[model samples]
Target: MKKITTPLKEKDIRALKAGEEVLLKGVIYTARDQAHKRLCDLIKKRRQLPFALKNQIIYYCGPTPAPPGKIIGSCGPTTSSRMDKFTIPLLKNGLKGMIGKGKRSAEIISAIKKYKAIYFLAPAGAGAYLSKFVKKKELISWPELGTEAIFRLEVEDFPLIVGIDIKGRSIYDKR
Candidate 1:
């Protein structure tokens, strides 16, 4: 498995291939559907985003509240396609990578290639297991959104599979 850190660089993203396993480290932000909408709104209004999109990664998740004595709770990837409507703007805004579950749409695949970005698939139905990898967590914005709020997490050796690479290769494609 390839081991990498964030914020992801163009070189690192380019070096990955569809279906490759990876161990991701460093910071990643969690954002679910609602948070994604808000972010897209920010981008559309030409307002500053809560975090830099350039060379950064967003994980599609709405983590449960941290349990006592644990740094985090069930935190795993949500479906990737749910965010498709908002993806292009983020890519254009310089988002380097995304970590989520499931396949992406054709348009998103094309956008990923056009923008030189990447999509990684985190293990689904493994939130409790994945939480162990989170070393730290901090709310980034919209606390009212609860679990759907954006959060910055510091993770170590988080496992993922390359769902789509910059070259337009998709794991969902026929062999």
Candidate 2:
């Protein structure tokens, strides 16, 4: 297995083919629909974002509340398709990669090709297992959005797979 980090540079993610196991490290952001829409709004207004998007990875997850003495609560990838509308704009604004579960839309695939970006998927139904990898968590913005709030998570050896590539390839695509 290879070790990968984000915001993913073009060369690194482009080099990742489908059917590969990877362990991820570094700071990754967590967001869902509301957070994504907010981010797009911020970008459109040319306002500063809570975190840097360049060379960073955005994980689509809405984790459960952590119990006392825990970094996070059942942190797993959410359904990726829901974020399809927000993704293209982020990618256009220098967002390099994404992490989540399930399939995405054809428009997202086309954007991936246009931007030379990558999409990774963590295991489904494995939130409890994945939470162990998050070493720390910081809520960056939109706390009022509840679980959809943007968060910065520092992860170590977070397990994942290359679900989509720059060539508009996706592992979830039925052959």
Candidate 3:
């Protein structure tokens, strides 16, 4: 297993291979369907995003509300393929990595190669267990969207696997 820290550099991303286990530390952003749609809309209008995308990692999750005395609630990766339409644009804007579950579309795989980015997979149905990795969480935008709100999270040793590497190698490939 490789231990990595984010915001991941190009070298860090390139060194990773599909199916390799990784333990990631540092800040990652959380965004789900609604947040992705809004981000894409902003990009279409050529407007500023709430935060910069350069060398950043986005985790596709909408965590449940935290209970009292907890830093965050159940947090796990959501289906990544659902955000396929918006992903390429984010990649073009310098987003370097993503953490989510499931296979990606051909277009997204192409974009991953084009942008020299990587896709990571967190275990499915392990939300409660994964929440322990989140050290801190702060709402960044779209509070009205509730669970779908964008958040800035500080995570430590968050477990994942390289589902797709920058070379377009994918763990989910049938071959």
Model 1, CA-based lDDT: 0.94
Q: What's the TM for model 2?
A: 0.95
lDDT of 3 by residue, 1-175 (tens): 7899988899998999999999999999999899999999999999999889999999999898999999999998999999998898899999999999999999899899999999999999899999999999999888999999989999999999999998999997857
Q: Candidate 1 residues 1-175, lDDT tens each?
A: 7899998888998899999999999999999899999999999899999998888999999998998999999998999899999999999998989999998899999999999999999999999999999999999999999999999999999999999999999998985
Cα lDDT of model 2 by residue, 1-175, tens digit: 7998765777788789866789999989999988988898998899998887877889999999889999999988889998998898788878888999888898898898898888888999899999999999999988898889998999999999988888888887766
Q: Report the Cα lDDT for residue 7, model 1.
A: 84
After superposition, the stretches of candidate 1 with alpha carbons farther than 4 Å from their true spots are none
Ranking of predictions according to lDDT = 1, 3, 2
Q: After superposition, how far is residue 85 of candidate 1 from its true place, in Å?
A: 0.3
Query: What lDDT would each prediction earn against the true structure?
Result: 0.94, 0.88, 0.94
TM-score of each: 0.98, 0.95, 0.98
- Which candidate leads the pack in lDDT? 1
lDDT head-to-head 1 vs 3, winner: 1
